[model samples]
Target: MKGFGLKVTETGAKSYIYQYRIGGRGSPTRRYTIGQHGSPWTPTTARTEAERLARLVGQGFDVVAQRQENERKSVSLAMPAYVEAFITNYLTTQWKDEADGAATLRKHVVPVLKSKSFPSLTRSDITAVIDKIPAGQMATRRKVFAILRKMIRWGIGRGDMPQQDNPLVGFEAPPAPASRDRTLTDGELVLAWNAADDLGYPFGPMVRLLIALGQRREETSAMEWNELDAASGVWTIPAAKSKNGKAHIVPLNDVALAVIDGLAGCADSAKSANSANSARRWPKRGLLFSTTGKTPASGYSKAKARLDKLMVDAEAKRAKETGDSAELIDAWRLHDLRRTMATGLQRLGVRFEVTEAVLNHVGGSKAGVAGVYQRHDWKEEKRDALQAWGRFLEQLAAGEPEQSNVVHLAARG
Candidate 1:
């Protein structure tokens, strides 16, 4: 009828259209496609739709303009898209530990809220996701919640998220886990180190290196051949892999270097075993603790559990020989070795600053303006301290008597 017609293409394809103007002749004309000229959009139905459009236009509705506006604003921002943009734009560029933040989102948040839209996601939805994390992993659960909250706040601030009040603003995160202060005793240390020796290759040598070096677990686990310089006796952790976004140099003493040397033999043995399989060939100079030679060693929990079992067995045997009641050693985590090292350094009369430096810890003695002005890396002091500690570890490993009450360290410049 009026302002309505069926247009036929050169190929004989047909569609119905409605053409109209808002302010009569003075306004530009607009065309709204009704539908293809098929069974649903027959001539009678198309005429009725055109009439309805004319009525709305007469009432100053501007149906075509309104439809265009709605179409422009209809893009749905789903949770996955928002999370991806947040990770790419904010986390990668700004966060010190970008990889971990990105991992938390991809592994925990994205999977649970894949179907939810950003604007429609509620506080309960997020709480449900946090609840899925095990009770024992409170630290991980708390971290995931904090990261998500930070991401949501960031999204809102950037206007990528909905303009309304942030749903996560008032939501509480999982309680922060209690601080850990567990340190292995000297006896426990000896037992654990011997157990690691028996455990062997990859995790075994890796743990021994950790006890001697006191570095982070992941950094030690993902050790590369290039990072170690046998002659220099230093292991350099690159900034990208470090927790604090800075490169860390760990001094290797006689004990630490021996672990590295043993790893070389282990790597050669592993390579020889896998030489028959072309796909599993071990790299000559790649991940030192890797089983596949492509990726770093994993399955840490299982390895740790095995080490614990070995320790218990050794403890029982020692108890039987001594005719003393067997007592279970206190449960300890890998991180406890770091604390034990720090404590041992204190007992050995190493300066607090040197201990902090050995751990590659930022701040403490070198925090605030002191951090900016103090250019000394304490490299020599670190070397001396680790050397002294290494000597101490060797004595323990050999079941030798304690040498001196305090070790003499080089004076810090």
Candidate 2:
């Protein structure tokens, strides 16, 4: 306790310090700040800590340097810094959809646990974040917690986090959302198609393409011009952008091609407008449904809401003319379009294998041993099925009878 003393700042804040020399007489003195004067660090505790530091310093341990190193490590191991490290080093390298995982951490995890150190985060800290998500958004809650658990486990394995106990250990993840079987009815499909026509540009053409192609919403929204071969009438989804990690080719019929053609003008106009405001030059074959021309078009929620309003208005107008009660269209998501396409394809007498192929689904006919053995791409079958589906949609839009004969033709092909 020879070099122990209480240092009071100008503002009257007092903290304990241990002053010592590393090399003995004539050596430069170093001061190691133990802690502030508080319940955890009173005179007696501070003196005991200073004595412990004296023992270490007497043994040539360089207590000041060790304390500095510990402080630096503590800062680096804080939740915010560690989250970025987890995203950069682990998520980017390992996950196909790294952007989603990174977004989840930044949106849900970082805001709640910003001041917590990775080793110090309690189960309550994580639960608090998860609880903030709405009960209806179980999928989002599940994803956020899953990514956090994986990130912590990855950090522990790589020695970036403590190995003693994980905050997420034995935690029951939110149950997955129920599988939806909500396919659009024929009347609903026609109403939606008309609504898309009214919606116009970017999302309008994008929705039309979704109805025509039957791909996932994200996939259809993120479609690129380069993915389409206008001459060959095919759109190829690369494995990197695909959910299934396999390249999928969709044969574009007249309907899909017309939607793409309209989008070309829309894309140019959007790009020109964006470039006029900013110095960013958009690539010719960049995102097809972009407003900024730098990233894929988002705002699906707002877009879908507008589309739904249009559908409800159109249905109401029709009801007024027919003397029926005006009613709201049943709630439907953009994903329901895929199911609608598959259902319509089945009605069109498309083979089960071909329908699955058209959707690029890896289940039913394409699962297990059949998947391993049957390597047929069903290119022609898919083309015929999608073409018939397109014709069926066109007929619905034209107020003509839905073409059942095309199904027989497609079956023959």
For every candidate, C-alpha RMSD to the true structure in Å: 9.8, 6.8
Name model 2 segments beyond 4 Å from true. Answer: 21-29, 58-69, 266-284, 402-413
* Model 2 Cα lDDT, one tens digit per residue, 1-413: 69999999999999998899988789998998989999899999999999999999878799889878988989889888889988989888787667667778988889988869888877898899999898988888999988988988887898766777787877788899888899998889878887888887788888888888899987887788788765566789989878898999999876776566566633322121112342222234788888897667766779999999999999999998999987657788989999999999999899999999999999999999999999999988888888788788777766668564332111111
TM-score for each candidate, following the candidate numbering: 0.69, 0.84
Q: Model 1 off-target regions past 4 Å?
A: 1-107, 110-114, 150-160, 163-165, 266-285, 291-295, 402-413
Q: Which pairs in model 2 have colliding backbones? A: none
